[model samples]
Target chain A: MPEISYRQAIKDALAEEIERDENVVVIGEEVAQYNGAYKVTEGLLERYGPKRIVDAPISEAGFIGMGIGASMLGVRPVMELMFWSFAYVAWDQIINNASSVRYMSGGLINVPIVIRGPANGGTNVGATHSHTPENLIANMPGLKVVCPATPYDAKGLMKSAIRDNDPVYVMESTLLYGTTGEVPEEEYVIPLGKADIKREGTDVTIVCHGPSVSVAMTAAQILKEEHDIDAEVLDLRSIRPLDEEAIITSVKKTNRAVLVEENRPFCGVDAQIAYTIQNKAFDYLDAPIQRVSTIDAPAIYSPAVEPEQLPKAANVVEKVLSIM
Target chain B: MVGFYREMVRIRRFEERSLRVYQQGKIGGFLHLYIGQESIAVACASLMGDHDHMITAYRNHGHALAVGMSMNECMAELLGKATGCSKGKGGSMHFFAPDKNYWGGHGIVGGQIPLGVGLAYGVKYKDQKGSAMAFMGDGAINQGAVHEAYNLAALWDLPAIFIIENNGYSMGTSQERSSSHPKEGLAARAEGYGMAWEIINGESLFAIRDGVGRAIKRAHEESKPTILEIHTYRYQGHSVADANAKKYRTKEEIDDYRKNHDPLNVYRLFLLDQKIMSEDEMKEIDGEAKQEAEVAAQFADESEFPTVESITEDVYWEADNPDKRTSEGRLFFND
Candidate 1:
C-alpha cells in the first residue's frame, strides 16, 4: 500500500491510461501548459506532450461538444471542467448530446468520454463557482455518475471510467483533493455502483458519497465515543447505478439509516436513496429514515453562512440522535 | 448535371409528401421540411468523399436523401417505425447513420457545431484523408458554441467545413432581428476566428458545388476548416406545426421566391438548357421522384413499431452485449 493524495491518484490514472491507449487524450482549459486550475492534471502535458494533453479555450460548450464528437469516432477524451458549475453553460452538449448519442444512434456510436472536475460547495467561491451537480447529471439515462470519497477510489474509478464505453461523469471535490489515503500502486479498478462500509457498526447506518463521506465518518466516530452509539459509515462510490441492494441490506441489519450529502435537499441524491430504503427495508427499520443535506437555497458567499448552508458532521450526528 | 437535378426533384417530392402525411396526422413529432433548400444538400453531398462525415440541424430530410440513405428508411424514421435508420427511436429531428458517415440531425440550434469539429479532429488524429461538414441555419451562427467551435477548428486546423444555410429566419424571427451584425452577413464573423470563409448563392447548384468543392479540397489537402455561408430559403413554414408562416412574411414575397428561385425548377431548367435532358426527360425524372416518394410512404406505413421488450434496450451499448453484460453483472456488489 502507498500513501498518496487524491490529486495524485487522478494524475496516475490519466498517465496510465494515456500510456495504455494511444487514443486517450486529456483536453481542457489550463490543462496543458498551465497544468490545471486545481493542478489535478499537473505534469500530464509534460509527459504526454501537446497532442495527448490538449489546451482548450474558455468555451465549455465548444470543447465539451468536441470531446463528445471525438469520442464517437473512437477517441477516448478526458474532458476537464474547471468547475462542475461551469457545465451549465454546456448543459445541452452534456445532457442531450453526450448522454443520448449512443441511444439515439441505435448503438452505432458510443461516447467513451470521461467528464471530470470538482463539484463542491462551502468553499466561499460564491454562488456561481460552487455547485454539486452529481444529482442533476445522474438524472440522465445514458450517463454514469461516480463520486469517489477517497484517493484509492478516485484513482481506480478514473481508470475504469476511461476504459468504459459509455459517458461517465467523475465528480471530484476540492475539499478531498488534498486529503491523503492509502492507495495500491498496482493496477486495480474499483468497479462502479459498489458501496463500501468504511466503519462497520450494529446501531445505525450513515449513507453518503463524495465529500459527505468524511462528514459521516467523523460523525460515526463522535457518536461512538460520546453517545455510546455504534454507527455504520457506508460510502456510495457510484450514484447513477445506485447500490440499492447494499443500502437495503445495511438498513435491514442496522434497522435505521440516515443519508448525508452536500447537495441541496430538493431532488437530491439522498431523496432517492431514502425512498429506496423506505420502499425496500421499511419493515426492518425501528426508526424513520432521515436525511442530512445542505439547505434548500442558493449557496451563500460568506464563510459563516456557507458552512451553515452545507452539511456538517454535527448535522449528521443530530439526525442520528433524533432518530434514536 | 442531370443527377443533381434528379436528387433535387427526389428531395422536393419527399418533402411534399411528408407535408401531406403530416397534415393527415400520420407523422408525429417535429416535421421540418427541406422543401425549398434541396440544392444545398445535393451539391454538398455530391462533393464529399466516401469517408467524409456530415452533421446538420433538424431540417435534414434532404441531407439524408442526398447522402444516399434509402427513402424507405428516412420515411420510416419520420413515421417512427422500427425499420428506420435510427431504429425508430430518433424521429425526424435525430436521423443518424454511422455506416454512411451521417452523424446526426440535431434539434438544438447550434448543438452540432462542436461535434462536427470533433469529428474532424478524429479524422486528423487517425490520419484519415477525409473531412467533416456541419450544416447549421443562419440563426445558429450567433451561438457562442458555434463561435467556440470555429476558434478551435482554426487553432487545431481540423478539416471541418461549417455550412450556414441562411434561410432568412430561425423558426419565426428573421436573421436581421437575431444576428448582431446582420448587415455584413454571417460569413464576415468567420474572419474573427481566423478561418478561411466564403459566401455563395444557395440557389445555384454550380456555385454551391464549386464553393464546397474548393473548401473540401483545401480540407483534404491542408487540414483547414472553412466557413461557407450559403444564401438559401425555405418555402414552407419551419415545421409542419408552423403553418402560419404567411402571417409573418407576405404572400407576395413567398410567391416571388417560389416562382423565380425554386431550386428544383431552376436545376431542371439548367439541365434542359445544358442539353443534358429534354423536356420529356425532365418530366420522366419528376414522375420517377413522385413514384419513389409514394413507395417510401407505403413502406413506412407497412413497417411495425419496435417490440415493447426493447424499450429498456439500447440505452447503453454494453447492455446489448450478452458477454459483457453477464461479466459486468457479476462485478456488481449485490450479485
Candidate 2:
C-alpha cells in the first residue's frame, strides 16, 4: 500500500495508462507546459514528451472536440478542462458531439475520451469559474459521469475511465486534490457506477459524493461522538449509470436517509438520489428523505458569502437528526 | 464528368423527394434540402479516398449521398425507421455512416470542426496517409469553436480540410448581416490563422473538384490544413418548416437563382455542351434518379420503428459488462 494525495493518484493513473498504451495522450489548456492549471497533471509532460502530453490553447470546445474526434479513430485522449464550469463554452462539442456520437453512429464508433477537471464549488471562484455540472452531464444518455471523493477512488476510476469505450466525464474536486489516502500499489480499477461506504452505521444513511463526502463523514463522526446517533456514510463515486442498488440497499438498512451534495438543490444529483430512495426504499424508510445541498442560486464571489450558500457538516447533521 | 453530373442529379432528386415526403407528413423532424448546394458535396466527396473522413453540419443529406450512403438508408433514417443508417436513432440532423468514414451530420452549427481536426490528428498520430474534411456553413464561421479548431489545426499542421459552404444565408440571417466583414467573407478569416485559403464557385463542379482536390492533396502530402470557401446557395428555405422564405428574401431572387444558377442545371449544361453525354443519356439518368428516390421512399415507409426494449440500448457500449450498473432495479415500482 502507498499513501498519496488525490492529485498524485490522478497523475499516477495518467502516467501508468500512457506507459501501457501508446494511444493514450493528455490534451488541454496548459496541461503540458504549465503542468495543468491545478497542477494535477504536474510532471506528466516530461515523462510522456510533447506528443503524448499536448498543450492546447484556451479553447475548451475545440480541444475537447478534437479529443473526441481523435478517440473515434484510434487514440485515447484524456482532455482536461481548467474548470468544469468552462465546459459551457464547449457545450455543443461535449453534449451534442462527444456524448451522442456513439449512439448516433449505431455503435460503429466509440469515443474513448476522458474529460477530467475540477467541478467543485466552494473555492470562491465565482459563478463563472465554479460549477458542479455532473448532474447536468449525467442527464445525457450516452455519457458516463464519475465523481471520485478519495485518492484511492481517483486513481482507480481514472484508469477505468481511460480504458472505457464510451465517453467518460471525470468530475474532480479542487478541494480534495491534496487530500491523502491509502491506495494499493498493484494495478487496480474501481468499476464505474459503484458506491463506496466511507463509514458504517445503522441509525441513518448520509449519501454523498465528491467534496460533500467529507462533509457527510464529518457529520457522521459528530453524530456518533456527540449525539450518540449512528449515521452511515455512503459515497457515490459515479453519478451517471448511478449505483442506485447501493443507494437503495443502504437506505433499506439504515431505514432513514439524507442526501448531501455541493450542487444546486434544483435538479441536482442529490435530488435524483432522494427520488430513487423514496421510490425503492419507501417501505423500509422510517422518515422522509432529507437533503443537504447548495442553496439554489449562482455561486457567490466572496469567501464569507460562499459558505452560507454551500452545504456544511452541520447541515447534514441537522438533516439526519431531524429525520431521527 | 457524366458520372459527376449523375451523382449531383441523384442528390438533387433525393433531396426533392425528401421534401415531398416531409410535406406529406411522412418524414418527421427537421429536413434540410441540398437542392442548390449539391456540387460542393459531390465534388469534395468525390476527392475523398477510401481512408479519408468526412463530417459536416445538419445540412448533411447531400454529403451523406455524396459519400455513398444508400438512398434507402438515408431515407429510412429521415423517416425514423429502424433500418436506417443510424438504426433510426439519429434522424435528419444526426446521420452517421462510420463504415464509409463519414463521422456524422452534427446538428450544432460549428460543433463538427474540432472533431474533424481530431480525426486528422488521429491519422497523423497513427502515421497514416489519410486526411479528414469538415464542412460548415456561413453561420458556423462566427462560432468560437471554428476559430479554436482553425488555430489548432494550423498550429499542429494536421491533415485536415475545412470547407465553408457559404450558402448566402445562415438559416434566415444573410451572411452580410451575420458576418463582421461581409464583403471579404469567411475566406478572409483564414489569413489570421496562417492557413492557405481560396474561394471557388460552388456552382461549377469542375472548379469545386479541382480546388478541393488540391487541398486534400496538400493535406495528405504536406500534412497541411486548408480553409476552402465555396460560394453556394440553398434553393429551399433553411429547413422544411421555413415555408415563408420570402419574408427574408424575395421570390424573384429565389426564382432567378433556381433558373440561372442551379448547380445541377449548370453541370448538366456543361456536360452536354462538352459532349460528355447525349440528351437521351442525360434524360435516362434523370429518370433513374427519380425512380431511385421513389424506391427509397417506399423502403422507408415499409420499415418499422425500433422496439421499446431497445430504448436503453446503445447508451453505453458494454450492456452486459459486470462493472456497468444502471439505475434499473433501484427505483422499480412494478414487480
Candidate 3:
C-alpha cells in the first residue's frame, strides 16, 4: 500500500479501467489535449489515444446526454463535467432520461455511465460555478451517488462506478483533491452504499460524507481533547444505497447523533440520515439528533463568508454539544 | 409498396383505437397520435438495415409499429397493462425495444436528438456500418439540445440523420410563428454545423424512401450526418388533452389536409396508379388492419395492471439482481 493524492487515485482508476475494458472511454470538455480542467485526466489522452479519450465541445447538455445515450448502447462512458454546477444544463438528460430510461423501458436498457466532477462550495467560484448536488442526485431513485473523501475510497469507488450496471454520479471535491490517503496497488472496488468508521467512539455519533468527513473527524478530535466526549466519525463513502445500517449502529452505541454535509439544510443528505437514525435507533437515543449543514443559500460568492457557509468542525462540535 | 401500405395502415388503425380508448378514459397519460404522418415512420422502417437504429419523440406509435413491435404490446402500454412493451412503466410517451435497435419514444422536445447522435457514435465505435435516425417535430428544431447534437454529429462525423417531421403546427403554435426561417427554412440550419441538409415531401412514401435512403447511405458509406426536414401533418390534437385542436386551426385546413394530402390516401393513389396491388386487396388489407387494432384494444382491456408489489422493481439493476450487486446498505429507503 502507498499514500496518494485523491486526484492521482482517480487517474489511476481510470487508466486501469480503460485498459481492462475496451468499451470504457472518457468523454468530456478539456479531458483530452487539455488533460481536463482539473488535470485529473493528464496523460490519459496520450495513453489511450483519441478514441478512448474524447474531447467534447463545451456543451454539457450535448455531451452529457450523448454519454447517456452511448451508455444505452454498448459503450461504457466515463463522462466528466468541469464542474457539477454545469450539470444543471443537462438536468433533463440526467433526471428525465438517464435516471428513468431503464425503469421506463421496463429494465430493457441501463445507463452504465459515470459522471464525475468537483461539486462543492468555498472555491471562490461564484454562484454559477459552485454547487453541491449529491443530495439532489441521491434523491433520484434510479441513479446512484458517491462522495469519496479519501484517496483509497476515490480509487475503489471510481472503479466500481465504472463497473456498475446503473448510472453512478461521483461527486469529487476540488478542496480535497490534494489530500492523501493509503491506496493499494492491487485491483479493488469499494462497493456503493457502504460506510467506514473513520474514528470510533461511544459518547456521540458524527456521521458525514465527502468533504464533511474531514470536518467530522476534526470535530471528533476537538470533542475528545477539550469536551472529554469520545465522538464517533462515520464517513458515508457513497450517498445513495446509503449506509443507514452503519449510521444506526453508531447512533445506537453513542445514544446521540450529529449528521453533517456540505449541502443546504432543507432536504439535504443529512436530513435523510437524521430521519433514518430516529426511525431505526429511536430507543437508543439519549437526546434529539442534531446536524450541521451548509447554510440555506445555494451558493455564496464572498470568499470570506463562503468558509462559514460550509459545515465547519466548530459548528459540528456545537451541534454535538447541543444534542449531548 | 404494399408492405409499406400495410405498415402505414396498421399504425393508423392502432392510433385511431388508442385515441378512442384515450377519449373513453381507458388510456392514461398523453396520447400523441401519428395520424397524418404515417408515411415518414413507415418509409424509414422499411429502409432500415441490420445496423440502422431509429428514435422518435412522443408521437411514436407509428415508429414503434413500423419497426415491427406488436400492436398488442403497444396498446397494452397505452392501457398501462402488465404485458405492455415497457411493462406499463412507460406509458404512451416512452416505448423502447433495444433488441430491434429502436432506442425510444422520448418525451422531451429535443432531448432525444443528442441521444440519437450518441447512438450513431456507438455505431462508429463498434465499427458497425450503420446510422441512427433521430426524428423530431418542427418544434424541436429550435431547442438548444438539437443544435448541440448537430454540432457533435458534424464534428465527430457520427452517422446521425437528424430528421425533423415538420408537421404544419407545433402544438397549437403554427410553424410560421414558433421558429425563425433563414434563407432555406429550418433544415438549412445544418449548414452552420457544416452538415448536409435537405427537405422532403413527407406525404409521399416514395419521396421518403429515396431521400431517407440516400441519407442513410451517406451515414453508412461516408460516416456523415444529415438533417432532413420531412414536411408532414397531424390530423389529431397535439395530445388528447389539447382542447383547441380544431379551435387553433380552421376546419377547412384540417379538411384540406385530410382530403388532398393524406399520407395514406396519397400513397394509396400512387400504389393504385402503379398497379402495386388490386383495389380489392387494398380494401382487404385495411379491414385486416382495423380488425388487428380491435383485437389489440380488447387484449389491452383484459390485461392486468402491474402488481402493487412490483412498484419497486426495475428502479435499480443491482436491486433487481442481488447476485451481481456488490454494494452494501439500503438501495431503497422507503417502504
Q: Chain A only: TM-score of every candidate?
A: 0.99, 0.98, 0.98
**Model 1 Cα lDDT, one tens digit per residue, B29-138:** 78999988999999999988866999998999899999999899999988888898888888898888888889998989999999999999999989999899999999
| Residue pairs of candidate 2 with colliding backbone atoms | none
Q: Provide the lDDT at A28 for model 1.
A: 95
What is candidate 2's CAPRI-style docking category based on DockQ?
A: medium
Winner by DockQ: 3
Q: What fraction of correct interface contacts does each candidate retain?
A: 0.54, 0.64, 0.80
TM-score of the B chain in each candidate versus the native B chain: 0.96, 0.94, 0.98
lDDT digits (tens) for residues B1-335 of candidate 2: 77888899999899999989998998787898888999998998888886689999999999999989999999999998889988888899888888888988998888899999999999999988888999999899988899999999999999999999998898889987888853566877878989989899988888998999888889989999999999888878899889777789988988988888888888888877889899999999999999999999999999998887666666677663436642222211122
Q: Model 1 over residues A110-212: C-alpha lDDT tens digits?
A: 8999999999997898989999999998788778899999999999989988988888899999999999999987899877777889889989999999999
Query: Which CAPRI category fits model 1?
Result: medium
Candidate 2: where are CA atoms >4 Å away? B320-335
Each prediction's whole-model lDDT (CA): 0.89, 0.88, 0.92
Alpha-carbon runs more than 4 Å astray in model 3:
none
DockQ of 2: 0.58
Model 2's TM-score against the true structure: 0.96
Give the TM-scores of the predictions, in the order they appear.
Answer: 0.97, 0.96, 0.99
